[model samples]
Target: MTVKDSCIVEAGTLLVGVGPDGAMERRYDVGIRVHEGLIAQVGAIEAVAYGNDHLPRYGSRGMIAMPGLVNGHHHFGLTPLMMGVPFAPLELWLPRFRAMRQIGNRLDTLYSAIEMLESGTTTVHHIQSGLTGTPDNWHAITSDILGAYDEIGMRAGYSFMMRDQNILAYEDDAKVLAALPEKVRDWLAPKLGAAATPTADYMDFFRAIRSGWAETSPDGVRVNLAPANLHWCSDESLQLMSQTAREAGASIHMHLVETERQAEYALKKFGHTAVQHLQKLECLGPEVTLGHGNWMTPEDLDIIAGCGCTMCHNASSGLRLGSGIAPVNEMRARQIPVALGIDQSNLADDRDMTLEMKLVWALHRETGLFNDRPDAAAVLQMATEHGAKSAGFGGLVGRVEPGLKADIVLMDEKAMARPFVSKRTPVEETVLHRGGRHAIDKVFVGGRLVVDGGKVISIDREAVMAEVAARLEAPETAAEAADWEMVNAMMPHLEAFHRDHPLVGERRPYRFNRITP
Candidate 1:
């Protein structure tokens, strides 16, 4: 297909992110003009291209146009549940991740990317994980992941997972190894061994990636730094990551306290909360995005807001892994930017941002009072504008306005507003409550049609899914099967350790009330 000079997206209802008063606005019978991969004009159809009707027109009547959804944090690989790993708490689940068989990097990336695109997500903050091997090998893997995104025409932010210590346990690898039986210890040594690359070496590789890809990649691709999580990385490693990110003008994303065990570990190891430790290390800044902050306290929220940092709420992942719900309402009340992410753990087991937005809106409605619930507009912002900023694409692709990248989604208004509500019913409200992947008619990234008629145009989705399914069903080696069995056997011991070391501090409770007694 040849690229055109200009195109028009004509919509019956348009939810523009900004209005004449600099607030979110809704317009009717609007046509958006695209030229050179950016929004050229936005107004009534007559004003955009009146007499000259030769330009390619994209949308049709009964179609609604809005900014493409942004997934603030995600792993560009297969979900663990799909790989035969049952959902467990974060600590127990981390070890089992090693036991899962490795599928080809390209296939896994394309598999997840297709799921995201088909669900109307045009931008993603892809946090790379399971990276191993020498520097050249890492480069090859990273390139392959980014190549898939480039071919699929989705905006992406890439960051490699970095960690130096505590591969298996919060206290020390040696301590955990000592507790296991000799046979089990020997079997896990290779899997949970010391870090293969030094902190300095990881920093060097990060610089190499920036020079090799960030400088020359397309308009939507960026490379950033991820220090994995608080328990997984040492203080020195976190400091280096922060320093490198600041020097390179890159962003940082890390998992904060996602579980009660992790919060307890922070108190035991650092004599403070994880958020405070990061603050002391000078890691809190506007460029930093904390992932799955399920255990953030009120003080932590205040500190995060003061530092100008943001949080990526993975509501489904938290629920799947039994991680407590995040204080999203409190975070918002404090004026901290909270974005939404699938984290490869949605209720539907696919990367559906619409469902994610709906889950975020519904999960936090703790009280039945309408006044204390999250409104449709707030959830939409978290999925779009706030998400864009968290993924380092702020002001570039989250809004449907002139001079901004034309990353947008078109939904069938009739399909969304089914059963015939009054004409005065707000389109945004309908979209948030009733919309799903089936309603997404088309998606555009950089003004290019990536999904049309509920199908991705850039790649063969059925073929890719077929290939991945076959690979997943392939016979596993004895060693691979044995590793999974051993990990399964080891879960009891790990659970005992956590049960003994409960959290000890003035921490927020996961639940507010108990059954009436």
Candidate 2:
């Protein structure tokens, strides 16, 4: 039966949490009672339905039930690769990305939601990387993005990236513009000016969006703030973002040290590491989430742990972009919460949290027999609990316990069992290794059956995708073609600007492929 006002979800095996000894804490023959979108009881089916015998029951009789996965860091559903933006280092890729033909907000958001939902992800932290519009424009865009989430029965935390400086490169905008040819410069100036909004206007825009969402949006959607990155935002922008997030009761997510050059840039500009500069600005607190902290130092870890901030690990993005491996094991040792994000750059080029977890599980197995490494439970926790916290849904929808929202995933037990195996293996391990969209039997978000039998029941995935394909099949418009031409014209100047910067040849604390001093 479909989920209604009240329902009972019965699972052959229910995964609750990890124990103190790192073993999976699971129960057999468990039933979860969801009422008014919140979990009311979790125990035997008879106990959960003692007085609610009239309630509908979802028969997950032999399936493995766990908390729905969270994607802590993601952008549009239509990935850059899909838009013809080839993978490059973050520094180089940023400019190339400006040339991608834009997709309609609703279509793009829905496409990603479908991929995440069918693969068992219930929530996503959407950090809008490109901000180019007025408040009125923002209202429509926000509505479309959040509207997509509401239509598909998925949860999302939305934030637009704010940047007031260094739009072209790490150097100042004026300097970069001065070095460019006048013809190219004139073409780029208006484009950049159109995206430029006053610092105060950004705060006002966020306030308006947050207020509107509180009144009309579903409980599953939230509004947060993102300052973009250290190089992109001015000091005033960073401080204001922090203040605005606190006032709005929202969280702040920022990209920091995604590449080694970013670290070197911070050192050259501020005479300190990016983490220290953030602390100096009083932005290193629990309400902040640092994305792709692959170049943080040991001292940075100390500050991050002390401030109780969360770090999102984007393993595949690092590998794909040549960014170094994050110090996830080190963060875990310091009692810092580490979350996993697909970063729209999963190794498979899809939004599969299960596969992301597997890559993380195998990537950080330190040297010898005595080294500390992430086990199955830790990785699962990153995907669920830590991810929930990072996405600004802390203590609300991560666990499948009483008082928590009923966002759950049901995996096919037979698929994981294969054509014969051992019963002694932990359920989390099996799911980590074998579970994926193909193995997801059903998915529920806030007592709503969003996906059933490996298909999203809330929306017509095939039809929507076909429409997107058809819409994209048309040839590029003149504006898009000219944008590509401008990108090509500006590449050499952009390259020279980066190559000749004082910190260009410096080495980060981490290793790289080949660095000639």
Candidate 3:
């Protein structure tokens, strides 16, 4: 593709951004013209049209055109191993992850990417600590995740979790403090082994992986160095990652104080809140997006706004994991771009944005003393534009407009657009109440069809399911539930954490699978 190559695509209801003016409710529909991948024309169907011969057409007669929903924070390869496990809050969820990581590299990557697209998402921001092992053992397996994303025809931002402090949660120091007895030492070896990969080595390891992943799909994937996640990430690692990402022209992602425990940890250890600590380290900026800002104080919210950083609200995960509700209303008031995440393969649940969407409304409605709340349209921005912006796509995506990538989703108009005759037509309300599998008619990534006719078109669904059954199933396929590495190491902590603060599973049986490796 030449730099100046242009293609035209015509669709109904082009939902382009109203520019930097922040007028999201307004849209322009002049059949999109794509030149070198960015949109070139957006207006009436007849005016400023694409060159007919060059622009291959897709007819979205009954579909609505909007920016593809971006998943701002996800652990990319969790799908194949999701079902048949327990939803035991974070503390309980950790040990289970070890058991599930035994699924190995190949199956995990493909399953995660495809499942994401099939469910109507087009871009992903993955907070990757990669598969649980030394990166050398896996050899850019997380990068291979983009292979699946490419095959599925979606855009992605890869953020490798960087940590120097713990050597995987301070495991190195914890390992050789031999004053502890031999029985204890013997027991400690496996846990230490799980965290054994040196942090610096992993950093180089992920950078090389990012390089390779980029080569595989080129423009389809963009990987940024991230602090991985909070709680486990050290101050030095966060600084290094921030510098690396800025120099690389990619954004930095991290889980900043996802829970109350993390908040408490930051206060006691760093003398400031989690956001404040990161601010002091100069880790906040437009190039950074912190996932799960559920425990922010009003002051913390100010810090996020002050730094121009973004927040990803993982609605279901926050509610499920018992992390506090993020102040979406407050963040929006500050003009801080808030985005959405499924937080799936969750050791928790499926990648269902509808569940998350509904929860966003529920939490804010219940909490607000007055009617102050995020309306449907505002949440839509969080899910789409704000998400892409947070993950670094910004104006290049997250909306249908001239000079923007034509990443679009055609929602099922039959169900979602009905009861609509101008006066009753509220696109945002339709999306919130009626949108789901039935409404997700097609999903497009950069003018390519990733989903069509309400199904994923890029991969063989049945074959993928077959692989899931054969490779990821039980009885000799994987390690015994007890024998898994991730589960054993973290199960004790999970159970203990739950002991103090038990999760009330309003929705029971959060699905997960055992990881033997």
Write model 1 residue lDDT over 1-517, tens digit each, in one string.
1232367898998888744333458888989999868899999988987754887788876899999999988985688887888877777887787788877778888888888888899999999884677787888888888888888778888888887787777767777777777777888787655345787898898888888775656476778899988988988889989999999888898988878778777878888889999999999999999998877677788899999999999999888888878888878778788889899669988899998898899888876555455678778888888889888788887889899988989999888877676777678888888888879999998888999999898988899889998888889999888988888777777777656655554544555111101
Residues 1-517 of candidate 3 have per-residue lDDT tens digits of 1122355655555555435645455443446666666666766666645245656565444556777778888875654335445655464454454445345545665666666676667888866654447655556566456556666667888766654443322233453334344543465556656654555666676578667765765666677766755556767767777776677677777877676556666776777788888888888888888887766777888888988888888877766666556767777778888889887643236665655676776666643367557767677777788888777677667877676776777776676656764536565666776777667777767776667777787778668767776765556533354445434554455344344443232432321100000
Clashes of each: 0, 0, 21
Model 1 score (lDDT): 0.82
What RMSD does each model have against the real structure? 2.8, 2.6, 6.1
Evaluate model 2: give its lDDT. Answer: 0.86
* Per-residue lDDT of 82 in model 2: 84
TM-score for model 1?
Answer: 0.94
Ranking by lDDT, best first? 2, 1, 3
- lDDT head-to-head 2 vs 3, winner: 2
Candidate with maximal TM-score: 2
Could you tell me which 10 consecutive residues in candidate 2 have the lowest summed lDDT?
508-517
Best by lDDT: 2
